[model samples]
Target: MRDPVATAMQVCPVEIATAVLGGSWKLTIVKHLLEEPLRRGQLKRRIPLAPDRTLTRQLRELEDDGIVHREVFDHVPPMVEYSLTELGHSLAPVVTVVDSWGATYRWTIDATK
Candidate 1:
Protein backbone atom coordinates (compact mmCIF):
# COMPACT_ATOMS: atom_id res chain seq x y z
CA MET A 1 0.00 0.00 0.00
CA ARG A 2 1.14 3.56 -0.55
CA ASP A 3 2.28 5.74 2.32
CA PRO A 4 -0.89 7.55 3.40
CA VAL A 5 0.92 10.46 5.04
CA ALA A 6 3.21 11.07 2.06
CA THR A 7 0.28 10.84 -0.34
CA ALA A 8 -1.69 13.29 1.81
CA MET A 9 1.19 15.75 1.92
CA GLN A 10 1.51 15.63 -1.86
CA VAL A 11 -2.08 16.76 -2.34
CA CYS A 12 -2.65 20.41 -3.31
CA PRO A 13 -4.57 22.70 -0.96
CA VAL A 14 -7.80 22.56 -2.94
CA GLU A 15 -7.55 18.81 -3.16
CA ILE A 16 -6.93 18.63 0.55
CA ALA A 17 -10.14 20.52 1.22
CA THR A 18 -12.03 18.16 -1.07
CA ALA A 19 -10.56 15.19 0.74
CA VAL A 20 -11.50 16.68 4.06
CA LEU A 21 -15.10 17.27 3.01
CA GLY A 22 -15.16 13.76 1.58
CA GLY A 23 -15.63 12.45 5.10
CA SER A 24 -18.81 10.67 6.20
CA TRP A 25 -21.16 13.55 6.89
CA LYS A 26 -19.75 16.30 4.69
CA LEU A 27 -21.04 15.08 1.35
CA THR A 28 -24.35 14.15 2.94
CA ILE A 29 -24.64 17.71 4.20
CA VAL A 30 -23.86 19.10 0.77
CA LYS A 31 -26.25 16.68 -0.90
CA HIS A 32 -29.10 17.81 1.34
CA LEU A 33 -28.29 21.46 0.71
CA LEU A 34 -28.53 20.79 -3.01
CA GLU A 35 -32.27 20.39 -2.67
CA GLU A 36 -32.97 22.91 0.13
CA PRO A 37 -31.50 24.96 2.88
CA LEU A 38 -31.53 23.42 6.39
CA ARG A 39 -30.95 24.72 9.83
CA ARG A 40 -28.18 23.29 12.04
CA GLY A 41 -30.55 21.13 14.08
CA GLN A 42 -32.28 19.91 10.97
CA LEU A 43 -28.98 18.93 9.44
CA LYS A 44 -28.07 17.14 12.62
CA ARG A 45 -31.33 15.23 12.55
CA ARG A 46 -30.96 14.38 8.87
CA ILE A 47 -27.41 13.09 9.17
CA PRO A 48 -26.90 11.10 12.33
CA LEU A 49 -23.86 9.35 10.95
CA ALA A 50 -21.23 11.64 12.39
CA PRO A 51 -20.81 13.43 15.69
CA ASP A 52 -21.64 17.11 15.83
CA ARG A 53 -17.97 18.02 16.20
CA THR A 54 -17.06 16.23 12.98
CA LEU A 55 -19.96 17.73 11.09
CA THR A 56 -19.18 21.18 12.41
CA ARG A 57 -15.58 20.84 11.31
CA GLN A 58 -16.67 19.80 7.83
CA LEU A 59 -19.06 22.75 7.56
CA ARG A 60 -16.36 25.17 8.62
CA GLU A 61 -14.05 23.81 5.94
CA LEU A 62 -16.73 24.12 3.27
CA GLU A 63 -17.55 27.65 4.41
CA ASP A 64 -13.89 28.58 4.26
CA ASP A 65 -13.76 27.25 0.70
CA GLY A 66 -16.76 29.41 -0.28
CA ILE A 67 -18.92 26.38 -0.89
CA VAL A 68 -21.35 26.55 2.02
CA HIS A 69 -23.15 29.65 3.30
CA ARG A 70 -24.30 30.03 6.88
CA GLU A 71 -27.06 32.44 7.70
CA VAL A 72 -27.83 33.49 11.24
CA PHE A 73 -31.32 34.71 12.08
CA ASP A 74 -31.67 37.00 15.04
CA HIS A 75 -34.58 35.92 17.16
CA VAL A 76 -35.52 34.51 20.53
CA PRO A 77 -34.63 31.08 19.24
CA PRO A 78 -31.68 32.32 17.15
CA MET A 79 -32.06 30.26 14.04
CA VAL A 80 -29.13 29.35 11.80
CA GLU A 81 -29.39 27.91 8.34
CA TYR A 82 -26.78 26.51 6.00
CA SER A 83 -27.12 26.65 2.26
CA LEU A 84 -24.88 26.26 -0.73
CA THR A 85 -23.02 29.21 -2.11
CA GLU A 86 -22.61 29.69 -5.87
CA LEU A 87 -19.43 27.69 -5.69
CA GLY A 88 -21.33 25.03 -3.79
CA HIS A 89 -24.02 24.89 -6.43
CA SER A 90 -21.25 24.00 -8.82
CA LEU A 91 -20.87 20.77 -6.87
CA ALA A 92 -24.34 19.53 -7.73
CA PRO A 93 -23.10 17.51 -10.67
CA VAL A 94 -20.28 16.00 -8.67
CA VAL A 95 -22.69 15.14 -5.87
CA THR A 96 -25.07 13.61 -8.38
CA VAL A 97 -22.33 11.35 -9.67
CA VAL A 98 -21.41 10.40 -6.13
CA ASP A 99 -25.01 9.61 -5.31
CA SER A 100 -25.38 7.47 -8.41
CA TRP A 101 -22.18 5.63 -7.68
CA GLY A 102 -23.11 5.09 -4.06
CA ALA A 103 -26.47 3.64 -4.97
CA THR A 104 -24.90 1.38 -7.57
CA TYR A 105 -22.10 0.13 -5.37
CA ARG A 106 -23.76 0.02 -1.97
CA TRP A 107 -24.71 -3.61 -2.27
CA THR A 108 -21.29 -4.59 -3.50
CA ILE A 109 -19.68 -2.66 -0.67
CA ASP A 110 -21.93 -4.22 1.93
CA ALA A 111 -21.28 -7.70 0.64
CA THR A 112 -17.60 -7.31 1.40
CA LYS A 113 -18.41 -7.34 5.10
Candidate 2:
Protein backbone atom coordinates (compact mmCIF):
# COMPACT_ATOMS: atom_id res chain seq x y z
CA MET A 1 0.00 0.00 0.00
CA ARG A 2 1.28 3.49 -0.83
CA ASP A 3 0.01 4.93 2.45
CA PRO A 4 -0.88 2.97 5.58
CA VAL A 5 -3.39 5.43 6.89
CA ALA A 6 -5.63 6.17 3.97
CA THR A 7 -7.50 9.49 4.18
CA ALA A 8 -10.17 8.33 1.78
CA MET A 9 -13.70 7.55 2.95
CA GLN A 10 -16.00 4.58 2.26
CA VAL A 11 -13.12 2.23 2.88
CA CYS A 12 -14.08 -1.19 4.23
CA PRO A 13 -12.71 -2.10 7.63
CA VAL A 14 -10.80 -5.01 6.17
CA GLU A 15 -9.46 -2.71 3.47
CA ILE A 16 -8.16 -0.33 6.12
CA ALA A 17 -6.44 -3.15 7.94
CA THR A 18 -4.86 -4.38 4.73
CA ALA A 19 -3.94 -0.88 3.72
CA VAL A 20 -2.06 -0.43 6.98
CA LEU A 21 -0.46 -3.84 7.13
CA GLY A 22 -0.33 -5.05 3.55
CA GLY A 23 3.41 -4.74 3.23
CA SER A 24 5.33 -7.99 3.02
CA TRP A 25 6.72 -7.65 6.51
CA LYS A 26 4.39 -5.28 8.31
CA LEU A 27 2.15 -7.93 9.88
CA THR A 28 5.12 -10.12 10.66
CA ILE A 29 6.84 -7.19 12.29
CA VAL A 30 3.76 -6.46 14.34
CA LYS A 31 3.49 -10.13 15.30
CA HIS A 32 7.04 -10.05 16.61
CA LEU A 33 6.67 -6.75 18.37
CA LEU A 34 3.55 -8.03 20.02
CA GLU A 35 5.72 -10.27 22.12
CA GLU A 36 8.27 -7.63 23.15
CA PRO A 37 10.26 -4.70 21.95
CA LEU A 38 13.04 -5.54 19.55
CA ARG A 39 16.07 -3.63 18.35
CA ARG A 40 16.47 -2.70 14.73
CA GLY A 41 19.12 -5.35 14.13
CA GLN A 42 17.01 -8.04 15.76
CA LEU A 43 14.14 -7.23 13.44
CA LYS A 44 16.51 -7.33 10.50
CA ARG A 45 17.58 -10.80 11.48
CA ARG A 46 14.02 -11.92 11.98
CA ILE A 47 12.91 -10.55 8.64
CA PRO A 48 15.92 -11.15 6.45
CA LEU A 49 13.92 -10.88 3.26
CA ALA A 50 13.20 -7.26 3.97
CA PRO A 51 16.10 -5.18 2.86
CA ASP A 52 17.26 -2.58 5.39
CA ARG A 53 15.70 0.22 3.36
CA THR A 54 12.39 -1.62 2.95
CA LEU A 55 12.22 -2.45 6.62
CA THR A 56 12.88 1.13 7.55
CA ARG A 57 10.13 2.36 5.29
CA GLN A 58 7.62 -0.13 6.70
CA LEU A 59 8.57 0.74 10.24
CA ARG A 60 8.19 4.42 9.45
CA GLU A 61 4.75 3.79 7.97
CA LEU A 62 3.67 1.74 11.01
CA GLU A 63 4.88 4.50 13.29
CA ASP A 64 2.95 7.05 11.26
CA ASP A 65 -0.18 4.97 11.61
CA GLY A 66 0.19 4.95 15.41
CA ILE A 67 0.57 1.19 15.21
CA VAL A 68 4.19 1.10 16.30
CA HIS A 69 6.23 2.89 18.92
CA ARG A 70 9.84 3.56 18.12
CA GLU A 71 12.35 4.52 20.75
CA VAL A 72 15.78 5.84 20.00
CA PHE A 73 18.51 5.58 22.57
CA ASP A 74 21.47 7.86 22.31
CA HIS A 75 24.66 5.88 22.32
CA VAL A 76 27.96 5.92 20.50
CA PRO A 77 25.82 4.17 17.94
CA PRO A 78 22.19 5.07 18.06
CA MET A 79 20.03 2.20 19.25
CA VAL A 80 16.48 2.03 18.03
CA GLU A 81 13.80 -0.28 19.35
CA TYR A 82 10.35 -1.05 18.00
CA SER A 83 7.32 -2.11 19.97
CA LEU A 84 3.62 -2.19 19.37
CA THR A 85 1.40 0.71 20.27
CA GLU A 86 -2.08 0.26 21.71
CA LEU A 87 -3.53 0.22 18.24
CA GLY A 88 -1.08 -2.41 17.16
CA HIS A 89 -1.65 -4.50 20.23
CA SER A 90 -5.34 -4.38 19.46
CA LEU A 91 -4.63 -6.45 16.38
CA ALA A 92 -3.63 -9.45 18.45
CA PRO A 93 -6.77 -11.36 17.52
CA VAL A 94 -6.40 -10.50 13.89
CA VAL A 95 -2.79 -11.59 13.85
CA THR A 96 -3.69 -14.77 15.65
CA VAL A 97 -6.27 -15.65 13.03
CA VAL A 98 -3.88 -14.85 10.22
CA ASP A 99 -1.17 -16.92 11.82
CA SER A 100 -3.50 -19.86 12.18
CA TRP A 101 -4.70 -19.52 8.62
CA GLY A 102 -1.16 -19.37 7.32
CA ALA A 103 -0.17 -22.44 9.26
CA THR A 104 -3.11 -24.33 7.86
CA TYR A 105 -2.35 -23.16 4.35
CA ARG A 106 1.27 -24.22 4.66
CA TRP A 107 0.26 -27.64 5.84
CA THR A 108 -2.23 -28.02 3.04
CA ILE A 109 0.30 -27.01 0.41
CA ASP A 110 2.98 -29.27 1.80
CA ALA A 111 0.57 -32.19 1.93
CA THR A 112 -0.35 -31.60 -1.70
CA LYS A 113 3.28 -31.43 -2.69
Candidate 3:
Protein backbone atom coordinates (compact mmCIF):
# COMPACT_ATOMS: atom_id res chain seq x y z
CA MET A 1 0.00 0.00 0.00
CA ARG A 2 1.20 3.44 -0.81
CA ASP A 3 1.78 5.71 2.17
CA PRO A 4 -0.28 8.78 1.61
CA VAL A 5 1.86 10.97 3.79
CA ALA A 6 5.04 9.95 2.03
CA THR A 7 3.45 10.36 -1.32
CA ALA A 8 2.23 13.83 -0.45
CA MET A 9 5.56 14.80 1.00
CA GLN A 10 7.39 13.85 -2.17
CA VAL A 11 6.05 16.90 -3.89
CA CYS A 12 8.26 19.28 -1.94
CA PRO A 13 10.73 18.44 0.79
CA VAL A 14 10.27 21.76 2.54
CA GLU A 15 6.50 21.59 2.44
CA ILE A 16 6.46 18.07 3.80
CA ALA A 17 8.95 19.02 6.50
CA THR A 18 6.75 21.87 7.55
CA ALA A 19 3.66 19.71 7.33
CA VAL A 20 5.26 17.15 9.60
CA LEU A 21 7.00 19.51 11.99
CA GLY A 22 5.17 22.79 11.49
CA GLY A 23 3.27 22.92 14.75
CA SER A 24 4.73 24.52 17.88
CA TRP A 25 4.23 21.41 20.00
CA LYS A 26 5.44 18.70 17.60
CA LEU A 27 9.05 19.89 17.63
CA THR A 28 8.94 20.31 21.39
CA ILE A 29 7.70 16.76 21.76
CA VAL A 30 10.47 15.59 19.44
CA LYS A 31 13.04 17.49 21.50
CA HIS A 32 11.96 15.74 24.67
CA LEU A 33 11.79 12.31 23.05
CA LEU A 34 15.40 12.76 21.98
CA GLU A 35 16.35 12.42 25.64
CA GLU A 36 14.50 9.14 26.37
CA PRO A 37 11.34 7.23 25.88
CA LEU A 38 8.48 8.57 27.98
CA ARG A 39 5.01 7.62 29.00
CA ARG A 40 2.09 9.79 27.95
CA GLY A 41 1.60 11.22 31.41
CA GLN A 42 5.28 12.03 31.69
CA LEU A 43 5.20 13.81 28.36
CA LYS A 44 2.19 15.79 29.46
CA ARG A 45 3.94 16.83 32.64
CA ARG A 46 6.95 17.97 30.65
CA ILE A 47 4.73 20.12 28.47
CA PRO A 48 2.31 21.37 31.05
CA LEU A 49 1.04 24.15 28.83
CA ALA A 50 -0.37 21.84 26.17
CA PRO A 51 -3.97 20.79 26.38
CA ASP A 52 -4.51 17.06 26.79
CA ARG A 53 -6.37 16.66 23.52
CA THR A 54 -3.89 18.79 21.61
CA LEU A 55 -1.01 16.71 22.87
CA THR A 56 -2.83 13.56 21.94
CA ARG A 57 -3.36 14.84 18.43
CA GLN A 58 0.25 15.91 18.05
CA LEU A 59 1.48 12.51 19.27
CA ARG A 60 -0.84 10.76 16.84
CA GLU A 61 0.48 12.88 14.00
CA LEU A 62 4.08 12.19 14.95
CA GLU A 63 3.38 8.49 15.10
CA ASP A 64 1.73 8.68 11.73
CA ASP A 65 4.73 10.50 10.27
CA GLY A 66 6.94 7.59 11.37
CA ILE A 67 9.05 9.92 13.48
CA VAL A 68 7.98 8.35 16.75
CA HIS A 69 7.19 4.80 17.75
CA ARG A 70 4.58 3.77 20.25
CA GLU A 71 4.85 0.59 22.27
CA VAL A 72 2.07 -0.88 24.33
CA PHE A 73 2.40 -3.57 26.94
CA ASP A 74 -0.40 -5.73 28.17
CA HIS A 75 -0.84 -5.31 31.88
CA VAL A 76 -3.47 -4.62 34.48
CA PRO A 77 -3.37 -0.93 33.78
CA PRO A 78 -1.63 -1.22 30.41
CA MET A 79 1.74 0.42 29.80
CA VAL A 80 2.36 2.63 26.81
CA GLU A 81 5.61 4.32 25.93
CA TYR A 82 6.76 6.65 23.16
CA SER A 83 10.20 6.75 21.67
CA LEU A 84 11.93 8.25 18.70
CA THR A 85 12.45 6.03 15.69
CA GLU A 86 15.81 5.84 13.87
CA LEU A 87 14.41 8.39 11.47
CA GLY A 88 13.41 10.51 14.41
CA HIS A 89 16.84 10.20 15.97
CA SER A 90 18.33 11.63 12.78
CA LEU A 91 16.54 14.87 13.57
CA ALA A 92 18.32 15.46 16.88
CA PRO A 93 20.97 17.72 15.41
CA VAL A 94 18.39 19.73 13.52
CA VAL A 95 16.35 20.19 16.67
CA THR A 96 19.44 21.22 18.61
CA VAL A 97 20.32 23.90 16.06
CA VAL A 98 16.76 25.19 15.98
CA ASP A 99 16.71 25.31 19.76
CA SER A 100 19.95 27.25 19.83
CA TRP A 101 18.65 29.66 17.23
CA GLY A 102 15.45 30.19 19.17
CA ALA A 103 17.34 30.91 22.39
CA THR A 104 19.60 33.39 20.62
CA TYR A 105 16.66 35.09 18.95
CA ARG A 106 14.82 35.43 22.25
CA TRP A 107 17.87 36.82 23.98
CA THR A 108 18.50 39.30 21.20
CA ILE A 109 14.90 40.50 21.27
CA ASP A 110 14.91 40.87 25.05
CA ALA A 111 18.17 42.80 24.95
CA THR A 112 16.87 45.12 22.29
CA LYS A 113 13.67 45.78 24.28
Off by over 4 Å in 1: 1-17, 109-113
Model 3 agreement with the true structure over 3-36: per-residue lDDT tens digits: 5457657788886777788775999999999999
Worst 10 residues of 3 by lDDT: 1-10
How many clashing residue pairs appear in each of the predictions shown? 0, 0, 0
Rank candidates by TM-score, best first: 3, 2, 1
lDDT of 2 by residue, 1-113 (tens): 24434642247787777678888789999999998999989999988889999999989989988899999999878888899999999999989999999999999999999
**C-alpha displacement of 91 in model 2, angstroms?**
0.9
Model 3 earns a TM-score of: 0.90
- RMSD, one per candidate, in order: 5.4, 2.0, 2.2
User: All models: lDDT?
Assistant: 0.80, 0.87, 0.90
lDDT score of residue 55 within candidate 3: 93
In candidate 1 the C-alpha lDDT for residue 3 amounts to 35
lDDT of 1 by residue, 14-102 (tens): 65545545666778889999989998788888888779898898788777667899999998888889999998898888889989999
TM-score of 2: 0.90
lDDT winner: 3
